[model samples]
Target: MRVVIIGAGLVGTSIAANLAADNDVIVVEDDPDRADQLQFDLDILSILGDGTSLATLQEAEVDDADMFIACTGDDRTNLVACGTAKTLGDPFTIARVKSAEYLRTWQRKHGAFGADHLVCSDLLTAENIVRVTGLPAAIDLDPFADGLVHMAEFEITADSPVASQTVAEADRFKSLTFAGLFRDGSVLIPGGETRIEAGDRAVVIGSPASVRGFSNDLNPSTTPDKADDIVIAGGSEIGYHTARLLEERESKSRLIERDETRARELAEELSGTVVMHQDATDVDFLSREHVDEADIVIATMPSDERNLLVAVLAKRLGVDRVIAVVNNDEYVTLFEEIGIDVAVNPRGVTAEEITRFSFESVAENLSVLENDQAEVLELELDSDSSMVGYTIRELDSELSGQFVVGALTRGGTLITPRGDTTLEAGDHVIIFVETSFADEIIARA
Candidate 1:
């Protein structure tokens, strides 16, 4: 597929890099320096021109492109670029929009602007925060279709009930199916005898009802805890976006801004949130405002130094959880080292979202990687395949190396197969294999 990406910043470059491996990609960037940087970093075509202009779209050959993505940080530019792409070509178009108001307005009016998809980074981040906060025990949660179905990651803690149970035995816990397990830096597609050991990170897929039931079975005492008091230190776009997200989740937040005019403007915009006109670095001011009582502290200020300082201070001040937005890649480890519960890089998060959305089939076709080398893939049984209607042990004859059929998805139901269990046509089977043997396994299966 031929893909044209506008804005060679982090998000655009990430999308280009990811798609370049399998598809033809061209990036259009306004900033000459950034465009040059991206061209130097990745093997993709770069066009230095304003993406919002019709001439730029024409110059980028949008008419022949299979996909056009507008990912500039500026909302107006992204929207105009997407509109121009739609006018210039019939290709699938996606726009990255940040404003909540714009999101609502765009959805209401001009709904058929020819943009195939609209990705709201603010909404994605907010949803992620809500999921993580709602289920503190879940290592990760990837929701599909606005929570219709979900893939959740949960670590097998010492307190987990199914720690030593086999795949078949643990299947009775709930109706959910175990997609894959990450253990010992390797992914394991467990069989009937495959045991669930402690320290294993298990990925499960199911509906909300089944997932909730499974979580309850895994940890009976687990409860949803809501953050009542939130302290946000920043008045930038990201900070404002975060505050709006928190308020939508029904959390009371206090936003600290050094600039009086900006603080007042934010205060007016976010009437429910408390806008504190003071420097976030002032520990005394934070203490005076009762930062001790905050359940969650979010530092999204522009400066990484100030964000790190405030995050560390919040951790010391007894905040339940601290999340800092670090723009620089170098500061990611520093934030973790300083005990910040979560460090979010908007660029990374946005890039991941775009990649995932773009490669919808890759998620199901590719295996879940525990490490960089090993992968666990779910393959569907073809009707004409030699392995169909054969038992697990019988099918082992054609396959090399140790392979296990972890779980089978047949007719939308998840089942843990035994050695005597037969693989039928149309059944999706999860298999674990080393990266070296991934191709062989897929081909043979």
Candidate 2:
């Protein structure tokens, strides 16, 4: 497949890097320095020109490209590029936007922007943040099969119940499967004898209830009951979305904004959430509001420095978990090293979401595992595809443990896979597959 990606930012560059190995990738970056650097570093072609320009599109050969993706920071630029590609070529169009308003416009009427898919970064970032709210020490979280199946990654601490146990021993959860483990910065496809070491990231696949239980058991310190008080600093889109989600759950949440007008607007938008127009970094204001009583503190401010400072201040005030929105991917590790419980990278998250559209099949939804080592895919079984009319126990040896079915949905009901469970046509199956064998699974599907 020949892919044309615009922006050459984190999202575009990453998609190019990932697809260059298997498909033809061309990147358009207006920044000459970044374009030159990418051209020198990557195997894909890079163009240093405005993406929305027709000449630039012609240079990138959009007419022959299989897919055109616009990921520039400007939503108008991305949409215009997609519309241009649509008007000029026969390629699939995808544009990344930060707001849902533009996406809604495209949805209300078909062919509005010539984009087949709209990837909203702010909404995706908010959804990701909300998923990790109650889960303990969850480095990543994804739901499949209509939320019946869950895939999550959590660190194994010394005190964790399954820290030192082998995969077989840790397979005590009735419906949970140990998908993989990350140790020494390498992904390990776990086997029966794969001993889980302390500090390793244990990835698991199971029903939502089972995964939630496992997370609580693995990190007993941050129990759901204890991790109740939620404090949100910054009235950004992410902050509003996070607080809105918590409002629906009836969670005790407080949002702080420095601007009076924005604070008033947030108060009107959010119900059951306390909105305060106070400087989050002011020691007196934070003390007056009992910052030490906060169990979770999320800093969603625009500035990285401000977010980091708020996170540090909240931690110093005895906040158990501090989540910071770090726009730069390089700052993710640094934020975690500096004691932030979780570092949310909107750019990286958006990049991963867009990249999955390329690898994920037409009938499948992809959820990447830790470090892109694997992906959990949910797809409906058709008569023409392989692996139909086979019971869980009847799977061939090569297809058995390498990938495990987490759950199945038939007739609007979810069924946790067992040895006796058989898959039929039209049944949606969620399976955990190693990244190395994704192509094989896709082939079978």
Candidate 3:
């Protein structure tokens, strides 16, 4: 596949880096330093010019590109670049936009703005926040097989019942598979004898019921119920969408906006939300509002620093979980290091969404994990697949790739992968594999 990505920003760079290994990647950047740096860092070709300019697109050979991604930070620039790319070539165009309005417009009319697919950063981040809230103990959660299967990452806290148990002992859930473990920045493909430690991040794939049951088993006290309170600090676009999405789930949230006008607008727009026009940083106001007693507190402040502060404050106030929206990619680690339960990065979310399209025809879905060290992919097997009709254990021994079949969905039923489980055609298998072996595994399967 030939990919031409514009902007060379965090999102564009991430996509290019992920694709450069398996596909021909060309990046167009307005900044010479960024373009040159990308070229130096990756094997991708870099074109230093305006992406929206026809001459620059020509220089990048966009006409021959199989995929054209416009991921500039600015919405107009991304849309314009995608529109320009359409005129140059029939490549699949993807645009990253900050506005939900653009996504809605594109959804209403496919191919609008010349973008075949549109990723809305704020909406994606908000959806991410809601997914985390659904599983408070999960560091990350993604659905597969049309929501029939769920892949979740959970930190095995010191108090967790399964913290000191072996993988075999921890495999109590009927429809859940312990996919992998992350410890000390390394990915571990665990075996039955593998012991789960306190700080190990365990990745599991299973049915929704099984995942939720596992979450409750890990953190029963923090699991939210229908009556639990969710407080959202800030009235930014992400915050508003978060509240709205929560409302859609029949979870009413209290939204704090320092700006009175915005608060009134939100209150008027969101019938289920309680909009409070007050500073989220005000400790006295938080105490009076009982924010400390909330089950979940989300910090979606405009700035990363403010969101960090709000998250820290929420934690100090004894909130069960604190999720913060991190605008800058560099701040994600810092936010998590300082004890925020989850740091949702919009750019990262957008990048992941757009990158999935690269395997749209091959893998049904893909989720990057541990900074690209591993990936969880969902694939539907056909009769032509080499491993069809073979037991998972047999296939594991036959294939050289480092991967584990986490879960399989057949006829809308979740099947926890076991050694004796037989691979069948039309089965949607979700596998956790080393990123290096992802493409090869997909091809072989």
Whose TM-score is greatest here? Answer: 3
Model 2: residue 217 alpha-carbon error in angstroms: 1.4
lDDT of 3: 0.90
Question: What's the C-alpha lDDT at position 89 in model 3?
Answer: 85
Runs off by more than 4 Å, candidate 1: 30-43, 48-56, 111-116, 145-149, 153-224, 235-278, 360-445
In model 3, which residue pairs have backbone atoms overlapping below 3 Å?
Answer: none
lDDT by residue for model 2 over 1-445, one digit each (tens)? Answer: 8999999888888777666767888999999999998888886689989999999999999999999999999999999999999877889899999987997898898567888899989888877887788674687888877777788888787778888888888776777877777788777778789898998988888887788778777776675743578899999988998899888777789999999999999999997899999999998899999987887889999888999999999999888778899998888889977768789999888988988788765446787665467777787888886778788767645473377677788887767688778789888887777777666666676
* Whole-model lDDT per candidate: 0.73, 0.83, 0.90
The TM-score between candidate 1 and the true structure equals 0.70
Query: How many pairs of residues collide in model 1?
Result: 0
Worst 10 residues of 3 by lDDT: 219-228
- Model 3: per-residue Cα lDDT at residue 369: 93
Query: Across residues 32-69, which tens digit of lDDT does each residue of candidate 1 receive?
Result: 99888888888778999999888988988999998888
TM-score of 3: 0.98
Off by over 4 Å in 3: none
Q: Mark the 10 consecutive residues where model 1 has the least summed lDDT.
A: 363-372
For model 3, residues 1-445, the per-residue Cα lDDT tens digits are: 8999998988998898878877899999989999899999996799989999999999989899999999999999999999999999899999999999999999999999999989999999999999988888889999999999999999888889998999999888899899999999888999989999998999999988988888888888877554368999999999999999999999869999999899999999999999999999999999999999888899998899898889998899898789999998888999988788888889889888988877787889999997888999999999999879999999889888778999998888888788999989999999999898887888876
lDDT, residue 104, model 1:
76
